[model samples]
Target: MSADEGARHPEDITVPDAVSAPDAEGRPRRVTRRFPLFTRDTARPEGSGRAAPLDAPAPARQWPILAVLSLVGIGLLLTALDVFRYGTLLIGVALLGGAVLRWLLPGVGMLAVRSRFTDIATYGVLGLAIALLAMMAQPDPWLEIPFLKDTLHFTVSG
Candidate 1:
C-alpha cells in the first residue's frame, strides 16, 4: 500500500477516548475547581491539620506577684517576732531612703522636696497639738494620740 493510502486509514492516528484511564507514570491534568464557603466536603483547613478537641484542657496560668507577696508576708512576720532594733532601722532606711533617693535626682528633686516639706510641716503641727492636749489632760485620758506618747496605754487602778 502507498504511504498516502496508509496515512488516510482510520487506524493511522490513535485518538484516546474518555473511557481510557491514565497509566501509572501519567497523571491526568487537574481541572481548577472552585469551592463555595458553605460547602462541607470541599472545605480544608487554613494552614495546618485538624485542631485540638473542644474537651481538651487548657494550660494553667501562674501569678509570680502572689508568690512575692507571700514571701513578703513571711518576712514581715519574722521581723515582728525578732524585735530587733537593727532590723527595724534597716527596713526603715532601705525603703524610705530609696524613695527619697529616687525623688532627689535632678529633675525630681524640687517636687520631692515640696512633698517632704508639706508632709513634715503638717505632721509636725499635728504632733505638737496632740502633745499639748495629752499634757493638759489627766494621767488616764479616754483619747490617746500616738504622736504625743511613745508608749500609749491605759492603766486601771482598783
Candidate 2:
C-alpha cells in the first residue's frame, strides 16, 4: 500500500461541495448562512423595526410646554427675590397650564413625560395644592383658609 492508500488522517478530510450557490451569472458566489448570536429576538419588538421619517415635523403645541416651564422658572426667580406670594402663584399657574396642555392636546412632545390622565391629574393637583399653600403662607397670607388657621396651631416651649 502506497502513502495515498494508507489510513486517512483527520487533516486530509475535504468538504464535498461548495457552501454557496452561484448567482445568475454562474460565478462561484459565496453564500453565507448566518445564525444569530442570540437565539431570541432581543433587539426590539417584531413589527417596530422601522424608524420614524426624518422629514416629519414636530407638533406645534410643544411651545406651550416651554412657556409653562418658563413661567415656573420665573416663579423661582421671584421667590429668590423675596416675593413668595406672586412667585408661588406663578408656579401654580404654570403647573395648571401644563395640565391644561396635557388635557387639551393629544401630543405634547417633550411634555408627555407620563400618561395623559396621569400627567393631567398630577399637574392639576400639584398646581392647586401649591396655589392653596401660597395663599395660606405666613407673615401676611393672601387668602385666609377657614379651618387651616386653627388646625395649624403648634406650640413649642423653649
lDDT values, one for every candidate: 0.39, 0.72
Measured by lDDT, the strongest candidate is: 2
For model 2, residues 1-158, the per-residue Cα lDDT tens digits are: 89888967655654444356678999757744654333444343222211223354443335656778899999999999999999999999899998897777655666665667777899999999999889878888878876755565643321
Candidate with maximal TM-score: 2
Model 1, residue 54: what's the lDDT? Answer: 37
TM-score of each: 0.21, 0.58
The digit string of per-residue lDDT tens for model 1 on 1-158 reads: 88876554443444444234556877644423543324335432122121223353321111222232344455456568873333333333333333343333322211222454453454345434543443445546546567545444333321
Give the poorly placed runs of model 1, Cα more than 4 Å off: 1-83, 106-158
Worst window of 10 by summed lDDT in candidate 2: 44-53
